[model samples]
Target: MFHAVAKGTPYSWANRYCYTGMFCWWGSTTYRRANSPGAAVDTGWGLKFFE
Candidate 1:
């Protein structure tokens, strides 16, 4: 499993790092310009599976 977070809605910068095995795992984060639109920042996380 993986997780992530962002700073702004109209994000300006973002990044993530992950690893995999029977299941996939990752970590991520994001940033946005001081002045932007939408919701101030955006963020998300996900998981992956391998056979």
Candidate 2:
């Protein structure tokens, strides 16, 4: 989870989570494993996955 990855509230970890969330939201679709059905939508725009 984001909380676990952001141990000690590290800046880099937080940034990575933010970026990954963005990528999953804009790159991966609702049907993809990365984006579940109940999860956020993906725009598939100028985003690069895992970025």
Candidate 3:
């Protein structure tokens, strides 16, 4: 269902590394500490890291 929502369309940046890495990193941090600050803000940080 997630894959279907993020189908491999050309403009699907989320289907690409931008969102992929963000969520992956987010999960990593959340796994370490669920109450981590700026987790949501880190999405933009992760996107910059990937790019």
The numbered model that scores best in lDDT is: 1
Best by TM-score: 1
Residue 28 error for model 1, in Å? 6.2
Clashing residue pairs, backbone N/CA/C < 3 A, model 1: 8-40, 8-41, 8-42, 9-40, 9-41
* TM-score of candidate 1 on Cα atoms, chains taken together: 0.23
Per-residue CA lDDT of model 2 for 3-51, tens digit only, reads 2234456566444543233334354423334545654544344433442
**Which residue pairs does candidate 2 place in steric collision?**
none
Give lDDT per model, in order: 0.48, 0.41, 0.33
lDDT of 1 at 11: 32
Per-candidate TM-scores read: 0.23, 0.14, 0.13
CA RMSD of all predictions: 10.0, 9.6, 11.0
Candidate 1, superposed: residue stretches over 4 Å from native? 1-21, 26-43
**Tens digit per residue, CA lDDT, model 3, 1-51:** 123223456655455532332223322232233556745433122212221
Model 1 over residues 1-51: C-alpha lDDT tens digits? 442333344433355424344665544645355576676766555454553
The stretch of ten residues in a row with the least summed lDDT in candidate 2 is 16-25
lDDT of 1 at 13: 32
lDDT of 2 at 51: 29
